[model samples]
Target chain A: MQQEQSIAFKTGMLSICLFILLGLLYLPPESVAQQESSVPPGTAIPDSIQLKPPIHIEVKDTPDDAGGSVTIRWEEQPVLENAVIQKYRILRASVENSVPGEFIFVGEATNRATVFSDGSTDDDSTYVYKVEAVYELKVDDTTVVTTTVQSSVSDEVSSSAQWFNFQRINVFVGVVLLSFFILYYIYQAQSGKKLFIRKIAGLEAVDEAVGRATEMGKKIFYIPGTQDMDNVQTIAGVTILGRVAEIAAQYDTWLEVPVSRSLVLVTAKEIVKEAYSKVGRPDAFREDQVHYLTDDQFGYAAGIDGMVVRERPATIFYMGAFYAESLILAETGNSIGAIQISGTAMPSQLPFFVAACDYTLIGEELFAASAYLSREPKLLGSLKGQDVGKALILISLLVGTILETFHIWQFSSLFKVIGE
Target chain B: MRREIPLLITAITGIVFVLQYFIPHAPFNKMNTWFSDWFSIVGAFAIWLGALNLLKISFQKIMDKKSDWFFALVIIISFFVITIIGFAEGQGFREPGTTFSWLYDYVYSPLSATMFAILAFFVASASYRAFRARNFEATLLLLSAFFVMLGRVPVGDIITGFLPQQYQLSQVASWIMTFPQTAGQRAIMIGIALGLVSTSLRIILGIERSHLGGGD
Candidate 1:
């Protein structure tokens, strides 16, 4: 009887262990099976796509206008003896502190050429580029839908193009005007010449918004945008944040800032602290008021939605780079009837902001906003210089178009030579 | 001196950028290229500065025993791990025939997809919240949003009975995205571009100085 009982007990334990082992092992496979069942065939990443070794790249002067643009060219992979090359993908990455892995898809073209023109007129910057060739494969002999297989990605092609050498006449004209302003401004600045800038209505309401929050004893919600610090718009957002924090400190209003990017979060903390210190309310600065949310876009948006719904801040300020989530956030804040002031350079999100927010800064206006609110002479002077530059561009455009219409090909050629 | 330096740099870079647009010659052409290279270098340095700043603040938060210290700790740990894996692994996931590459392929790639998959729920919830007909404009907005959403999913075809026939719901969706939607987007883009130009001009000319914290 004892021997029989022991055998049964041993068998039960063995079955339990087997169940646990199978449970753990079965989970991942089950999950994967569920995913496969739901996902349509051919939607997932194929087995063939890859990054080849980095390759030597060459940069040459671009044709047309002043040489602000560079044409980068690299050798294509020798076509396999049997396989047909279908397309080339050009990827670009900036050189500084940038993870080389963050290659941006710049251009894609059929196997006709291996050269690409980098005509980004912003300024001189060094960028590393990579190229990959996709090869054609006949998945089935019966149908025309040939599944294209990407070979091991071609080597990353690197090239450096400098825009310092290209100075054109239109640029010269713009330079002359700018030089005149700078010289004029330097003398004026030395003499302490006072300049007047127009008042920014959006900024004017900031103090009132904070005061209202203070009166109601409600927290203030501030979003410094969803972009990393590498973006210029984020820089502007942080600077404006300095002013907001100062008002919050003076009014003793609860100020909460949730940031999507770690870098931007850090900047906001510094700016907010500085503002608090400047307001002589350093003790009131709470570090937790500015916190880093997840870097995931929708995750951050989800967090913001929760915060807005739960806390119900009386005033919300959104400043910086925004994308699709802008509408979701603005609409939520609107539902809460929060007074919203938003500033961003994202053209796509501006309409949503305009529709939802009480005040919206459009495009470059966001960049100029802090200055507009400050009315400082130097800032005002720079804005004037920018205006002069634009006017010069506009005048040049008019003259060039008129000359082209009149068959004065030489004048037309002047502007036609960019990004060749 | 504080304001003068920025003004000079802005004026110089701004003018050169304009000139290069019209004159395509040797020295001037080359100068533009050099300028672009310099800008790239500056941009690179700026990125480094930002990264350093991020490390400094997170480290500070951890040191101070702040209320959200745990979150800060997670951030620092994740940042360092990612950085080390990225640099130490060299080309990281892009490196073929490596463990890191497989990790990226199976782990990071799927994680990204899963995160995007989560968006499906949030989008549905957000649509539910936004679709109420509060006013005429709101009604119009709800209508457009519904069509846009339906036009994207396979269920739209099932409801409309269009895809099996030549009038594929996907093609109709593409047309909606490309034409009327595109027109609206483009109009907004044009306004934004003009606004940007004018605003940049105002800043360069120093007519807008509120950002410097003295306009008050």
Candidate 2:
């Protein structure tokens, strides 16, 4: 009897021990140490328990921008004991497409982020948003609990296109100020005022460059660049071309302009014809003088190269928007002992032109060349006005630097243009 | 009337463009698109004019037996062959595996690449002249170019391995690029921007009319 009783107790104890082991293996982890395994700080636990949602959900249209965006802001709930806030999940629904109270997941942000810019909104549709807060609770020494709570849905809000982007007020003011200066100077010029312009070496060399070609009795090659007529650089180039054409016509020198774009060819021919007429040599301007080449970039370069080699012009003028071909053209001109004058706004190609050409007009100097060559009072006044605008910009830069360094003010922020 | 009409149009168009920059409203928002569409239409017609001009010039050269008339003949033949192929292949001419695509890939692309490849030789020859160190400015340019070139290569690290990390030649090259080079580029950019603004203003106000074949 004693042996049978002992065996019964042993079996019962073994069954109970096996049951406890299975329970431990299958149940959700309760030990805080085990649950905290390798979880770095600030990572949200997906399992949520009940908590107070963020309060005062606010929705507003994004200001000073094109439509199609709404901004969401919320105030966090008052802190409670044992509830550590995690991240907030944002839910949004289009009023046009969904049943009431049903929403699709839009985005999420950390608890610290109070504002969210929702950019995927349609300009015409109204939207409602919900802000849900997630939190963690340590109920006991061995257990960590997660909870989530949602706030009331925001009222329907829609984004509308703004008529004026006020954020760019600073840029508008700058442009207006420049216009005022230019107009005032132009009026001064129209009334009888002598405007002094600092002499530009490139413009000074022009008359000499043309004179050399005339003396040598060689054809003058004028390449108005590879760009079409629409580029501002090309316009500057062709304007300078007018002055060059007049000089060429006066000298009775042969001038050739092999253009890459058809429109540029037409424009150049018109300018040359008018220039010739102005010089009392209308018969001298041939339609074929300004001709078209292939529109391909490198092909245009190759054609110019071939012409330069064959014709061996004494002077070559490269003015406009040139790319890699700038070096090719300049180097070819260099090899033939031709005087090369190049002007372009392209910063990358400026180095090449400076390296290879006899005279180079850098950046703003290209624009100034027209006025410098023509010596028109109105144009000269405009150049002088540009100097004034540049002066103002210099003042702003100095002021901004000093103010920022001293931490007295953020003067640079005034120049920040926010909207396009 | 001829000059006045064009100038008026230019002024109106310029004003509308400035308005569009400040306002995103209906007609202003679509003005640029409408104008660009018109330009493309004109450009398409101009392409034919260009082709005809090329043909006329080439034929004239071939008939007159100008120097290198054979090249003109080749240009004419190649132009027609490619035009015929492009038309015959229809809309799918640009698709892969088509004869037109094959021609573009094998002939046109290689020719373009060859032309671009010639630029490297030109750059080398030009750099030889520019980096001559003839004066103070040239010597500065030469030094900067040498350091920039050295730092871009693996050998730069090996050469400066004994120096402190910040004092390495590669780091020096990076500092030059990040500071002095960028400053110069930005200065030029600012000048260009001011010039562009000033020039555009002149054009809009009709103070600059040389582009329209009128004297200032």
Candidate 3:
């Protein structure tokens, strides 16, 4: 009975000790902070603890661009020159009723950076921004201390869509002026005013090539290039094709067009049919004459080469946009002893055509071919309008060069293309 | 009626597109994108029309036992096989290991590369004919081509090693390309741009109607 009483006394003591330990664990954290502040004298306080935030934080919508972006800029604090700043953190908050909501970390820039472009915002939405300068203080080999002090919150700025970019005003003016000149000349021509157009040898040879094919009793092959109707060069090529088809209908010669684009094929068919009907030979018009070949570049070239070898056409007309296949098609036509006439606005392919074909239209001449061949007053007047435009460009270039030579840059700057 | 309707449509659309360049307002920009989408959709339909036309011609040639009818048969069979493989395999038809991809990699790719390779021979022949020095202009062209060819290779450096680096063949070639060639190219581009603008104006004003098949 005496030993059991001694054991009960020891258990009571142990329960009291356990209660004391749990009480220490649940104590308020402020006491610990108070104790740390009560450090003994002569201890050094780190300089990073006194670091200041960046100054003059500003945010606004970026100018001269398609919207949906805001630019944030700030000035570095003087303390940054002495302190070892690691980086600056940019924080963004959505604005509601003139108040910033919960701040979200947007991005980080290096210590040297003073600008940041925030491209994540929605259009027509207001946003507030802040920049925090971060400083690191290494206490030991294993522990590095970091302190981030944020600047004054930026003013609310909203990204909004812009109508008619002011940056492209130069281009707009140029187009307006050119269109005015062209329209004026066209009106004059319509009113029966005669306009002179220079003769293009390549265009003049079109009739000769068609006649040669007719005399030889051989077919004429017309390729309107490999590109679709979207290309201006291809459209020009089809315009030339219309004239060629008319000649073929009149001469009663076989005309074939193998196109690489579906739209071109349909357009070519309509054009050929119309040409025959215009010549009063609708009976001779065949829908099967103009057809679509493969859209593949080399495949189209191979197909044309095979046709040239097998059918041995007397004349071949290549008028359109071409790339590497230009040389291949031209050389094959030359080999087959055909009178090849090629026209393209592709500067790179011009050399190949000139080298291999009997007649070649150099750049602008290809675009001018239809007007020259048709001799329509409206088309002739347009050519005169183009000459005036050229004269204006030449004068501008000469003036710009002279101004630049004399260190006068304002005139040249007027021609600068913006928002590209 | 046919001519008038088409001309009206052309004028309206052309004016809209031209104005689209200057106006970046919401509805104007939206309309520009919508028109472009319509063109793409119409182009898709045109592809079907073209395919049907091709089939009609090939089938007729096969029936008539025309010369090279075997090629027509080959085209028909290949088109069906490829189309079937593409449809059956879905989007993965173009993936590596599929039949469509295998045909493209082994057959179409090689044929394309072969045709491109033939350009080297053709260039050689064309250059020979062009560089024949038949006349004064031809001789000038030949000289320029020779200088360009020589400057583009290591042999040029070795041949002109006696000159200073600034006056080296490659340096001269660079100068030619940068100055004279660029100037000439810019002039042509300017001319082409003017011509394009004038031609487009004529079309938009309904003054040029040859493309509508010689209509008044």
Per-candidate local distance difference test: 0.65, 0.86, 0.84
What digit string (tens of lDDT, one per residue) describes model 2 on residues A1-420? 999999999999999999988876765422322344433456444344346678788999987666778999999567667678788878888899887666776788887889888888988899999887766776656557665667888988998778887887888899999888988887888798988888888889988999999999999999999998778899999999999999999999999999999888778888999999999999999877888889999999988998899889999999999999999999999999999999999999999999999999999999988888988888888888888999998898889888889996667888887753
Please, what are the lDDT tens digits per residue for candidate 1 over residues A1-420?
Answer: 999999999999999999987886656432333343322366443345332322445555464334345566666665443345667666566666456455556667667676767665223456655555555533334322223322223332333334343434444454456656644653574477775545667778888888889998999999988877546677678767877887889889999998876656656877787778888888998767887666677667766877798779999999999987887788788879899999987877776787778888776567666656555555555555555555665686689879888888886566542434
**Interface RMSD in Å per candidate, to 1 decimal?**
6.4, 1.2, 1.6
Report, for candidate 1, the interface RMSD: 6.4
lDDT, residue B79, model 1: 69
lDDT (tens digit, per residue) of candidate 3 on A93-210: 7886433345677799998899998878777578888887776654445445555667878998987656776777898788888888877887798899988787787888889999
Ranking by DockQ: 3, 2, 1
Best by DockQ: 3
Backbone clashes, each candidate: 73, 4, 0
Clashing pairs in 3: none
Model 2: runs farther than 4 Å from truth?
A1-54, A75-90, A93-98, A104-114, A118-126, A132-149
Kindly report, for each predicted structure in the order presented, the TM-score of its chain A compared with the true chain A. Answer: 0.59, 0.80, 0.81
Query: TM-scores, in order shown?
Result: 0.53, 0.86, 0.86
